[model samples]
Target: MLTVLMLGDSLVEWGDWPSLLPEVAVINRGIAGEMTEELSARLMDEIDACPDPDAVLIQSGTNNLLFGYILFPTMLITMLQRLRLCYPSVPLIVNSLMPMPIVAPHDLEQINRELAVAAAATENCHFLDTVGPFQEQCLPITHPGFLNDQVHLSTRGYQVWAATIKGLLEQLFPGKLPG
Candidate 1:
Protein backbone atom coordinates (compact mmCIF):
# COMPACT_ATOMS: atom_id res chain seq x y z
CA MET A 1 0.00 0.00 0.00
CA LEU A 2 1.69 3.18 -1.25
CA THR A 3 0.53 6.77 -0.96
CA VAL A 4 0.38 9.16 -3.89
CA LEU A 5 -0.24 12.87 -3.57
CA MET A 6 -1.53 14.88 -6.49
CA LEU A 7 -0.75 18.61 -6.28
CA GLY A 8 -1.92 21.15 -8.80
CA ASP A 9 -5.13 22.65 -10.11
CA SER A 10 -8.55 21.18 -10.88
CA LEU A 11 -6.93 19.12 -13.64
CA VAL A 12 -5.40 16.75 -11.13
CA GLU A 13 -8.69 16.48 -9.29
CA TRP A 14 -11.44 16.91 -11.91
CA GLY A 15 -12.35 13.24 -12.17
CA ASP A 16 -11.71 12.23 -8.59
CA TRP A 17 -9.08 9.79 -9.84
CA PRO A 18 -7.33 9.89 -6.52
CA SER A 19 -10.32 8.86 -4.52
CA LEU A 20 -11.36 6.22 -7.03
CA LEU A 21 -8.14 4.34 -6.50
CA PRO A 22 -8.30 2.74 -3.09
CA GLU A 23 -5.03 0.83 -3.05
CA VAL A 24 -2.68 3.72 -3.79
CA ALA A 25 -4.09 6.00 -1.15
CA VAL A 26 -4.14 8.98 -3.53
CA ILE A 27 -4.46 12.54 -2.31
CA ASN A 28 -5.79 15.28 -4.50
CA ARG A 29 -4.63 18.60 -3.14
CA GLY A 30 -5.71 20.66 -6.10
CA ILE A 31 -7.12 24.13 -5.54
CA ALA A 32 -9.50 25.12 -8.31
CA GLY A 33 -8.23 28.66 -8.93
CA GLU A 34 -4.60 28.52 -7.95
CA MET A 35 -1.31 29.25 -9.65
CA THR A 36 2.23 28.23 -8.75
CA GLU A 37 2.69 31.16 -6.43
CA GLU A 38 -0.45 30.30 -4.55
CA LEU A 39 0.65 26.68 -4.42
CA SER A 40 4.09 27.76 -3.29
CA ALA A 41 2.60 29.93 -0.61
CA ARG A 42 0.68 27.01 0.77
CA LEU A 43 3.19 24.24 0.06
CA MET A 44 3.62 23.22 3.67
CA ASP A 45 -0.08 22.91 4.28
CA GLU A 46 -0.51 20.89 1.13
CA ILE A 47 2.40 18.61 1.88
CA ASP A 48 1.58 18.17 5.53
CA ALA A 49 -1.97 17.10 4.85
CA CYS A 50 -1.19 14.15 2.59
CA PRO A 51 -0.83 10.63 3.98
CA ASP A 52 2.93 10.27 3.62
CA PRO A 53 2.66 9.64 -0.08
CA ASP A 54 5.47 7.74 -1.71
CA ALA A 55 4.92 9.65 -4.93
CA VAL A 56 3.76 13.21 -5.65
CA LEU A 57 2.19 14.31 -8.91
CA ILE A 58 2.57 18.04 -9.51
CA GLN A 59 0.51 19.77 -12.23
CA SER A 60 0.64 23.51 -11.55
CA GLY A 61 1.22 26.94 -13.18
CA THR A 62 -1.62 27.30 -15.69
CA ASN A 63 -3.25 30.22 -13.87
CA ASN A 64 -0.06 32.24 -14.09
CA LEU A 65 -0.40 32.24 -17.86
CA LEU A 66 -3.88 33.70 -17.49
CA PHE A 67 -2.32 36.63 -15.63
CA GLY A 68 0.00 37.23 -18.64
CA TYR A 69 2.95 38.36 -16.54
CA ILE A 70 5.24 35.34 -16.28
CA LEU A 71 6.84 32.73 -18.54
CA PHE A 72 5.63 29.16 -18.02
CA PRO A 73 9.02 27.43 -18.18
CA THR A 74 10.78 29.67 -15.71
CA MET A 75 7.93 29.44 -13.30
CA LEU A 76 7.92 25.65 -13.65
CA ILE A 77 11.65 25.51 -12.96
CA THR A 78 11.23 27.57 -9.85
CA MET A 79 8.35 25.42 -8.74
CA LEU A 80 10.19 22.16 -9.36
CA GLN A 81 13.17 23.45 -7.40
CA ARG A 82 11.04 24.33 -4.43
CA LEU A 83 9.29 20.98 -4.37
CA ARG A 84 12.58 19.18 -4.70
CA LEU A 85 13.96 21.01 -1.71
CA CYS A 86 10.88 20.16 0.30
CA TYR A 87 10.80 16.47 -0.57
CA PRO A 88 14.18 15.58 -1.93
CA SER A 89 13.75 11.84 -1.97
CA VAL A 90 10.15 11.31 -2.92
CA PRO A 91 9.31 10.38 -6.49
CA LEU A 92 8.01 13.44 -8.33
CA ILE A 93 5.67 13.44 -11.29
CA VAL A 94 5.56 16.88 -12.88
CA ASN A 95 2.50 17.05 -15.10
CA SER A 96 2.65 19.61 -17.88
CA LEU A 97 0.34 22.52 -17.28
CA MET A 98 -2.69 21.63 -19.34
CA PRO A 99 -3.42 23.51 -22.54
CA MET A 100 -6.07 26.17 -22.37
CA PRO A 101 -8.82 27.16 -24.76
CA ILE A 102 -7.44 28.61 -27.98
CA VAL A 103 -6.01 32.08 -27.44
CA ALA A 104 -2.94 34.15 -28.14
CA PRO A 105 -0.27 34.92 -25.57
CA HIS A 106 -2.09 32.39 -23.46
CA ASP A 107 -1.01 29.28 -25.29
CA LEU A 108 0.05 28.10 -21.87
CA GLU A 109 -0.19 24.37 -22.49
CA GLN A 110 2.59 24.02 -25.02
CA ILE A 111 4.85 26.28 -23.05
CA ASN A 112 4.23 24.13 -20.05
CA ARG A 113 5.20 21.09 -22.08
CA GLU A 114 8.56 22.62 -22.73
CA LEU A 115 8.83 23.33 -19.08
CA ALA A 116 7.81 19.79 -18.26
CA VAL A 117 10.52 18.44 -20.51
CA ALA A 118 13.05 20.63 -18.79
CA ALA A 119 11.81 19.63 -15.40
CA ALA A 120 12.05 15.95 -16.34
CA ALA A 121 15.68 16.52 -17.13
CA THR A 122 16.28 17.06 -13.45
CA GLU A 123 17.29 14.17 -11.22
CA ASN A 124 14.00 13.37 -9.54
CA CYS A 125 11.47 15.14 -11.73
CA HIS A 126 9.58 13.46 -14.58
CA PHE A 127 7.24 15.35 -16.89
CA LEU A 128 3.78 14.09 -17.68
CA ASP A 129 2.26 15.64 -20.79
CA THR A 130 -1.48 16.19 -20.60
CA VAL A 131 -1.77 17.71 -24.05
CA GLY A 132 -4.59 15.62 -25.40
CA PRO A 133 -7.93 17.31 -26.04
CA PHE A 134 -6.90 19.41 -23.10
CA GLN A 135 -5.22 21.27 -25.93
CA GLU A 136 -5.84 21.50 -29.66
CA GLN A 137 -2.86 19.60 -31.07
CA CYS A 138 -0.58 20.90 -28.37
CA LEU A 139 -1.81 24.49 -28.60
CA PRO A 140 -5.20 25.13 -27.06
CA ILE A 141 -7.48 22.77 -25.23
CA THR A 142 -10.93 21.50 -26.19
CA HIS A 143 -13.75 20.29 -23.99
CA PRO A 144 -16.91 18.97 -25.59
CA GLY A 145 -18.25 18.04 -22.19
CA PHE A 146 -18.13 21.64 -20.95
CA LEU A 147 -19.74 23.26 -23.96
CA ASN A 148 -16.35 23.72 -25.59
CA ASP A 149 -14.74 25.66 -22.76
CA GLN A 150 -11.69 23.41 -23.33
CA VAL A 151 -9.81 24.44 -20.21
CA HIS A 152 -11.90 22.60 -17.69
CA LEU A 153 -12.46 18.88 -17.87
CA SER A 154 -15.94 17.70 -18.49
CA THR A 155 -16.60 14.10 -17.42
CA ARG A 156 -15.51 13.08 -20.88
CA GLY A 157 -12.51 15.33 -20.68
CA TYR A 158 -11.40 13.69 -17.50
CA GLN A 159 -11.90 10.34 -19.11
CA VAL A 160 -9.64 11.34 -21.94
CA TRP A 161 -7.03 12.58 -19.52
CA ALA A 162 -7.25 9.39 -17.58
CA ALA A 163 -6.87 7.35 -20.72
CA THR A 164 -3.83 9.23 -21.94
CA ILE A 165 -1.99 9.30 -18.66
CA LYS A 166 -3.11 5.92 -17.40
CA GLY A 167 -0.29 4.09 -19.13
CA LEU A 168 2.34 6.33 -17.65
CA LEU A 169 0.71 6.23 -14.29
CA GLU A 170 0.85 2.48 -14.38
CA GLN A 171 4.35 2.45 -15.76
CA LEU A 172 5.79 4.41 -12.91
CA PHE A 173 3.41 3.35 -10.23
CA PRO A 174 2.53 -0.20 -11.37
CA GLY A 175 -1.18 -0.69 -10.74
CA LYS A 176 -1.73 2.24 -8.44
CA LEU A 177 -3.90 4.83 -10.32
CA PRO A 178 -6.64 2.53 -11.56
CA GLY A 179 -7.57 2.30 -15.21
Candidate 2:
Protein backbone atom coordinates (compact mmCIF):
# COMPACT_ATOMS: atom_id res chain seq x y z
CA MET A 1 0.00 0.00 0.00
CA LEU A 2 1.15 3.56 -0.67
CA THR A 3 2.02 5.39 2.53
CA VAL A 4 1.53 9.12 2.99
CA LEU A 5 2.53 11.36 5.87
CA MET A 6 -0.27 13.77 6.69
CA LEU A 7 0.71 16.72 8.86
CA GLY A 8 -1.02 19.83 10.19
CA ASP A 9 -3.70 20.95 12.65
CA SER A 10 -7.25 20.03 13.56
CA LEU A 11 -8.34 19.49 9.99
CA VAL A 12 -5.72 16.85 9.53
CA GLU A 13 -5.99 15.50 13.07
CA TRP A 14 -9.73 15.07 12.92
CA GLY A 15 -9.84 13.21 9.66
CA ASP A 16 -10.57 9.50 9.85
CA TRP A 17 -7.99 8.86 7.17
CA PRO A 18 -8.20 5.08 7.32
CA SER A 19 -11.88 5.36 6.52
CA LEU A 20 -11.34 8.23 4.11
CA LEU A 21 -8.59 6.59 2.06
CA PRO A 22 -8.89 2.89 2.66
CA GLU A 23 -6.42 1.99 -0.07
CA VAL A 24 -3.53 4.05 1.33
CA ALA A 25 -1.52 3.72 4.50
CA VAL A 26 -1.69 7.03 6.35
CA ILE A 27 0.69 8.36 8.95
CA ASN A 28 -1.30 11.17 10.50
CA ARG A 29 0.80 13.58 12.52
CA GLY A 30 -1.85 16.15 13.06
CA ILE A 31 -2.25 18.15 16.27
CA ALA A 32 -5.40 19.94 17.12
CA GLY A 33 -5.01 23.74 17.46
CA GLU A 34 -1.55 23.69 15.94
CA MET A 35 -0.39 26.67 13.92
CA THR A 36 2.01 26.70 10.99
CA GLU A 37 4.95 27.58 13.20
CA GLU A 38 4.22 24.73 15.58
CA LEU A 39 3.84 22.31 12.72
CA SER A 40 7.17 23.46 11.28
CA ALA A 41 8.85 23.09 14.63
CA ARG A 42 7.68 19.54 15.10
CA LEU A 43 7.93 18.49 11.46
CA MET A 44 11.33 16.84 11.73
CA ASP A 45 10.25 14.79 14.69
CA GLU A 46 7.15 13.67 12.90
CA ILE A 47 9.18 12.77 9.85
CA ASP A 48 11.76 10.93 11.93
CA ALA A 49 9.09 8.69 13.39
CA CYS A 50 7.84 7.75 9.96
CA PRO A 51 11.32 7.66 8.38
CA ASP A 52 10.04 7.31 4.85
CA PRO A 53 6.79 7.88 2.99
CA ASP A 54 5.66 7.80 -0.61
CA ALA A 55 4.22 11.31 -0.27
CA VAL A 56 3.50 14.07 2.24
CA LEU A 57 0.27 16.00 2.62
CA ILE A 58 0.01 19.16 4.68
CA GLN A 59 -3.15 21.00 5.80
CA SER A 60 -2.35 23.91 8.05
CA GLY A 61 -2.71 27.70 8.61
CA THR A 62 -6.29 27.79 9.77
CA ASN A 63 -5.24 28.07 13.40
CA ASN A 64 -2.80 30.77 12.42
CA LEU A 65 -5.62 32.70 10.80
CA LEU A 66 -7.88 32.15 13.79
CA PHE A 67 -5.18 33.54 16.05
CA GLY A 68 -4.80 36.58 13.79
CA TYR A 69 -1.54 35.46 12.34
CA ILE A 70 -1.98 36.30 8.69
CA LEU A 71 1.64 36.00 7.62
CA PHE A 72 1.77 32.19 7.75
CA PRO A 73 2.86 31.44 4.20
CA THR A 74 6.45 32.23 5.05
CA MET A 75 6.48 29.52 7.69
CA LEU A 76 4.63 27.13 5.40
CA ILE A 77 7.24 27.64 2.68
CA THR A 78 9.96 27.00 5.20
CA MET A 79 8.28 23.75 6.18
CA LEU A 80 8.04 22.71 2.55
CA GLN A 81 11.69 23.52 2.07
CA ARG A 82 12.59 21.35 5.04
CA LEU A 83 10.53 18.50 3.63
CA ARG A 84 12.23 18.83 0.25
CA LEU A 85 15.63 18.69 1.88
CA CYS A 86 14.69 15.49 3.66
CA TYR A 87 12.82 13.69 0.88
CA PRO A 88 14.12 15.18 -2.31
CA SER A 89 11.90 13.25 -4.69
CA VAL A 90 8.82 12.68 -2.61
CA PRO A 91 5.65 14.47 -3.66
CA LEU A 92 4.59 17.26 -1.31
CA ILE A 93 0.91 18.07 -1.46
CA VAL A 94 -0.06 21.40 0.09
CA ASN A 95 -3.73 21.70 0.85
CA SER A 96 -5.16 25.21 0.65
CA LEU A 97 -6.84 26.62 3.74
CA MET A 98 -10.59 26.20 3.55
CA PRO A 99 -12.86 29.22 3.67
CA MET A 100 -14.35 29.94 7.07
CA PRO A 101 -17.14 32.23 8.08
CA ILE A 102 -14.81 34.04 10.45
CA VAL A 103 -12.36 35.00 7.75
CA ALA A 104 -13.07 37.54 5.07
CA PRO A 105 -13.28 36.02 1.61
CA HIS A 106 -10.66 38.35 0.19
CA ASP A 107 -8.21 37.59 2.95
CA LEU A 108 -8.62 33.84 2.49
CA GLU A 109 -8.20 34.25 -1.26
CA GLN A 110 -4.99 36.22 -0.82
CA ILE A 111 -3.56 33.65 1.55
CA ASN A 112 -4.44 30.79 -0.77
CA ARG A 113 -2.88 32.67 -3.68
CA GLU A 114 0.34 33.09 -1.77
CA LEU A 115 0.34 29.40 -0.85
CA ALA A 116 -0.23 28.42 -4.49
CA VAL A 117 2.69 30.56 -5.58
CA ALA A 118 4.91 29.01 -2.97
CA ALA A 119 3.92 25.48 -3.99
CA ALA A 120 4.44 26.22 -7.67
CA ALA A 121 7.89 27.59 -6.98
CA THR A 122 8.90 24.51 -5.04
CA GLU A 123 10.03 21.40 -6.89
CA ASN A 124 7.91 18.26 -6.60
CA CYS A 125 5.20 20.17 -4.78
CA HIS A 126 1.50 20.35 -5.67
CA PHE A 127 -1.17 22.65 -4.28
CA LEU A 128 -4.65 21.24 -3.75
CA ASP A 129 -7.14 24.04 -4.32
CA THR A 130 -10.02 23.12 -2.01
CA VAL A 131 -11.69 26.54 -1.98
CA GLY A 132 -13.64 26.35 -5.23
CA PRO A 133 -14.75 22.79 -4.64
CA PHE A 134 -15.94 23.50 -1.12
CA GLN A 135 -17.73 26.62 -2.23
CA GLU A 136 -19.39 24.81 -5.08
CA GLN A 137 -20.48 21.93 -2.89
CA CYS A 138 -21.86 24.09 -0.12
CA LEU A 139 -23.56 26.72 -2.23
CA PRO A 140 -26.85 28.41 -1.15
CA ILE A 141 -26.05 27.49 2.42
CA THR A 142 -23.93 29.98 4.31
CA HIS A 143 -21.82 27.44 6.16
CA PRO A 144 -22.78 23.92 5.24
CA GLY A 145 -19.15 22.93 4.82
CA PHE A 146 -18.31 23.85 8.39
CA LEU A 147 -19.44 23.02 11.88
CA ASN A 148 -21.36 25.49 14.04
CA ASP A 149 -18.10 27.06 15.19
CA GLN A 150 -17.35 27.83 11.54
CA VAL A 151 -13.81 26.59 12.03
CA HIS A 152 -14.04 22.79 12.04
CA LEU A 153 -15.40 20.80 9.12
CA SER A 154 -18.78 19.18 8.86
CA THR A 155 -19.40 15.67 7.52
CA ARG A 156 -20.22 17.06 4.09
CA GLY A 157 -17.14 19.22 4.23
CA TYR A 158 -14.89 16.26 4.92
CA GLN A 159 -16.49 14.33 2.08
CA VAL A 160 -15.63 17.13 -0.28
CA TRP A 161 -12.10 17.29 1.05
CA ALA A 162 -11.68 13.53 0.78
CA ALA A 163 -12.98 13.50 -2.77
CA THR A 164 -10.52 16.21 -3.72
CA ILE A 165 -7.66 14.32 -2.11
CA LYS A 166 -8.68 11.08 -3.79
CA GLY A 167 -8.75 12.78 -7.17
CA LEU A 168 -5.35 14.34 -6.62
CA LEU A 169 -3.87 11.07 -5.41
CA GLU A 170 -5.22 9.27 -8.44
CA GLN A 171 -3.69 11.87 -10.71
CA LEU A 172 -0.37 11.73 -8.93
CA PHE A 173 -0.10 7.98 -8.50
CA PRO A 174 -2.34 6.84 -11.39
CA GLY A 175 -3.55 3.23 -11.04
CA LYS A 176 -2.05 2.98 -7.54
CA LEU A 177 -5.23 4.21 -5.88
CA PRO A 178 -8.38 2.12 -6.03
CA GLY A 179 -11.55 3.45 -7.68
Candidate 3:
Protein backbone atom coordinates (compact mmCIF):
# COMPACT_ATOMS: atom_id res chain seq x y z
CA MET A 1 0.00 0.00 0.00
CA LEU A 2 1.20 3.53 -0.73
CA THR A 3 1.57 5.65 2.38
CA VAL A 4 2.07 9.41 2.55
CA LEU A 5 2.77 11.55 5.59
CA MET A 6 1.38 15.07 5.36
CA LEU A 7 2.49 17.66 7.88
CA GLY A 8 1.50 21.28 8.36
CA ASP A 9 -0.93 23.62 10.00
CA SER A 10 -4.67 24.01 9.25
CA LEU A 11 -4.01 24.64 5.54
CA VAL A 12 -2.62 21.15 5.27
CA GLU A 13 -5.64 19.71 7.04
CA TRP A 14 -8.17 21.56 4.88
CA GLY A 15 -7.78 19.09 2.01
CA ASP A 16 -10.03 16.04 2.20
CA TRP A 17 -7.26 13.80 0.94
CA PRO A 18 -8.11 11.06 3.46
CA SER A 19 -11.60 10.44 2.07
CA LEU A 20 -10.47 11.24 -1.43
CA LEU A 21 -7.56 8.79 -1.33
CA PRO A 22 -8.85 5.57 0.14
CA GLU A 23 -6.46 3.47 -1.91
CA VAL A 24 -3.53 5.17 -0.27
CA ALA A 25 -2.69 5.67 3.40
CA VAL A 26 -2.75 9.40 4.11
CA ILE A 27 -1.50 10.32 7.55
CA ASN A 28 -2.30 13.95 8.25
CA ARG A 29 -0.19 15.63 10.90
CA GLY A 30 -1.76 19.04 10.68
CA ILE A 31 -2.25 21.00 13.87
CA ALA A 32 -3.94 24.35 13.75
CA GLY A 33 -1.75 27.32 14.77
CA GLU A 34 1.55 25.46 14.53
CA MET A 35 4.87 27.02 13.65
CA THR A 36 8.03 25.65 12.08
CA GLU A 37 9.61 25.24 15.49
CA GLU A 38 6.62 23.26 16.67
CA LEU A 39 6.76 21.06 13.59
CA SER A 40 10.47 20.54 13.95
CA ALA A 41 9.92 19.62 17.59
CA ARG A 42 7.39 17.00 16.55
CA LEU A 43 9.57 15.66 13.78
CA MET A 44 10.39 12.46 15.64
CA ASP A 45 6.77 11.48 16.08
CA GLU A 46 5.87 12.28 12.48
CA ILE A 47 8.84 10.33 11.18
CA ASP A 48 7.93 7.44 13.43
CA ALA A 49 4.41 7.29 12.04
CA CYS A 50 5.66 7.67 8.49
CA PRO A 51 8.15 4.88 8.51
CA ASP A 52 7.91 4.29 4.78
CA PRO A 53 5.90 7.04 3.17
CA ASP A 54 6.02 6.99 -0.62
CA ALA A 55 5.92 10.75 -0.39
CA VAL A 56 5.59 13.56 2.16
CA LEU A 57 3.56 16.68 1.43
CA ILE A 58 4.41 19.68 3.59
CA GLN A 59 2.23 22.84 3.75
CA SER A 60 3.38 24.80 6.74
CA GLY A 61 5.17 28.00 7.91
CA THR A 62 2.42 30.58 7.38
CA ASN A 63 1.92 30.72 11.09
CA ASN A 64 5.62 30.91 11.55
CA LEU A 65 6.06 33.88 9.28
CA LEU A 66 2.96 35.61 10.59
CA PHE A 67 4.06 35.18 14.19
CA GLY A 68 7.78 34.52 14.33
CA TYR A 69 10.89 36.42 13.34
CA ILE A 70 12.57 33.60 11.43
CA LEU A 71 12.94 34.21 7.73
CA PHE A 72 10.40 32.16 5.82
CA PRO A 73 12.98 30.81 3.43
CA THR A 74 15.25 29.73 6.23
CA MET A 75 12.41 28.02 8.06
CA LEU A 76 11.48 26.14 4.90
CA ILE A 77 15.03 25.05 4.34
CA THR A 78 15.19 23.90 7.94
CA MET A 79 12.04 21.81 7.59
CA LEU A 80 13.22 20.28 4.31
CA GLN A 81 16.65 19.48 5.69
CA ARG A 82 15.22 17.80 8.75
CA LEU A 83 12.71 15.75 6.77
CA ARG A 84 15.33 14.76 4.21
CA LEU A 85 17.63 13.59 6.95
CA CYS A 86 14.86 11.45 8.41
CA TYR A 87 13.85 9.74 5.15
CA PRO A 88 16.32 10.47 2.43
CA SER A 89 14.63 8.19 -0.09
CA VAL A 90 11.09 9.40 0.43
CA PRO A 91 9.82 11.69 -2.34
CA LEU A 92 9.44 15.11 -0.73
CA ILE A 93 6.83 17.52 -2.10
CA VAL A 94 6.63 20.90 -0.38
CA ASN A 95 3.25 22.50 -0.94
CA SER A 96 3.50 26.30 -1.18
CA LEU A 97 1.71 28.46 1.34
CA MET A 98 -1.54 29.99 0.12
CA PRO A 99 -1.97 33.62 -0.88
CA MET A 100 -3.36 36.24 1.51
CA PRO A 101 -4.72 39.48 0.14
CA ILE A 102 -5.03 41.06 3.57
CA VAL A 103 -1.36 40.47 4.14
CA ALA A 104 0.66 42.47 1.67
CA PRO A 105 2.34 40.69 -1.23
CA HIS A 106 5.65 41.42 0.50
CA ASP A 107 4.72 39.60 3.68
CA LEU A 108 4.09 35.96 4.55
CA GLU A 109 2.69 34.88 1.17
CA GLN A 110 5.58 36.37 -0.75
CA ILE A 111 8.09 34.87 1.64
CA ASN A 112 6.39 31.53 1.31
CA ARG A 113 6.58 31.80 -2.47
CA GLU A 114 10.26 32.57 -2.27
CA LEU A 115 10.76 29.57 -0.02
CA ALA A 116 8.99 27.36 -2.53
CA VAL A 117 11.18 28.65 -5.33
CA ALA A 118 14.29 28.12 -3.24
CA ALA A 119 13.28 24.59 -2.36
CA ALA A 120 12.73 23.87 -6.03
CA ALA A 121 16.43 24.46 -6.61
CA THR A 122 17.42 21.76 -4.15
CA GLU A 123 17.56 17.99 -4.75
CA ASN A 124 14.80 15.52 -3.73
CA CYS A 125 12.51 18.44 -2.87
CA HIS A 126 9.72 19.44 -5.26
CA PHE A 127 8.49 22.93 -4.43
CA LEU A 128 4.90 23.20 -5.58
CA ASP A 129 3.90 26.76 -6.42
CA THR A 130 0.62 27.52 -4.70
CA VAL A 131 0.12 31.03 -6.12
CA GLY A 132 -0.81 29.52 -9.48
CA PRO A 133 -4.43 28.57 -8.70
CA PHE A 134 -5.07 30.40 -5.46
CA GLN A 135 -4.62 33.71 -7.18
CA GLU A 136 -6.99 35.65 -9.44
CA GLN A 137 -5.58 35.94 -12.96
CA CYS A 138 -2.00 35.99 -11.71
CA LEU A 139 -2.77 38.45 -8.94
CA PRO A 140 -3.20 38.01 -5.21
CA ILE A 141 -6.81 37.32 -4.33
CA THR A 142 -9.04 35.87 -1.60
CA HIS A 143 -12.06 34.30 -3.19
CA PRO A 144 -14.34 31.64 -1.72
CA GLY A 145 -13.25 29.55 -4.71
CA PHE A 146 -9.75 29.47 -3.30
CA LEU A 147 -9.37 30.24 0.40
CA ASN A 148 -11.34 29.98 3.59
CA ASP A 149 -8.93 32.38 5.24
CA GLN A 150 -5.84 34.20 4.19
CA VAL A 151 -4.15 30.80 4.51
CA HIS A 152 -6.76 28.07 4.81
CA LEU A 153 -8.60 26.58 1.86
CA SER A 154 -12.22 25.77 1.27
CA THR A 155 -13.48 22.72 -0.68
CA ARG A 156 -13.02 24.63 -3.88
CA GLY A 157 -9.55 25.48 -2.72
CA TYR A 158 -8.74 21.83 -2.26
CA GLN A 159 -10.08 21.20 -5.76
CA VAL A 160 -7.28 23.31 -7.14
CA TRP A 161 -4.81 21.46 -4.96
CA ALA A 162 -6.11 18.07 -6.06
CA ALA A 163 -5.73 19.11 -9.66
CA THR A 164 -2.14 20.17 -9.11
CA ILE A 165 -1.22 16.97 -7.32
CA LYS A 166 -2.99 14.87 -9.92
CA GLY A 167 -0.79 16.31 -12.61
CA LEU A 168 2.31 15.55 -10.58
CA LEU A 169 1.31 11.93 -9.96
CA GLU A 170 2.78 10.77 -13.23
CA GLN A 171 6.18 12.15 -12.37
CA LEU A 172 6.17 11.33 -8.63
CA PHE A 173 4.95 7.80 -9.21
CA PRO A 174 3.79 6.43 -12.53
CA GLY A 175 0.24 5.07 -12.38
CA LYS A 176 0.08 5.79 -8.65
CA LEU A 177 -1.21 8.43 -6.24
CA PRO A 178 1.17 11.27 -5.44
CA GLY A 179 -0.22 11.56 -1.87
Cα misplacement distance, residue 117 of candidate 2 (Å): 0.9
Q: State which candidate has the highest lDDT.
A: 2
Where is the poorest 10-residue window by lDDT in model 2? 134-143
Residue ranges of candidate 3 with Cα displaced over 4 Å: 68-70, 136-143, 146-149
Which structure is stronger by TM-score: 2 or 3?
Answer: 2
Q: What would the TM-scores of all predictions be?
A: 0.76, 0.96, 0.82
Ranking by lDDT: 2, 3, 1
Give me candidate 3's TM-score against the actual structure: 0.82
Better of 2 and 3 by lDDT: 2
Candidate 2's C-alpha runs over 4 A off are 140-143
C-alpha displacement of 36 in model 3, angstroms?
Answer: 1.2
lDDT of 3 by residue, 1-179 (tens): 67778898877666688665555677888888888778878988888876888888887777876675546567667778877888888878887766655556767556766776767765788877767666643333433644535556666667676666656645778777534
Best by TM-score: 2
- Please list all clashing residue pairs in model 3, or write none if there are none: none
Q: Which whole-number lDDT from 0 to 100 does residue 81 have in model 3?
A: 81
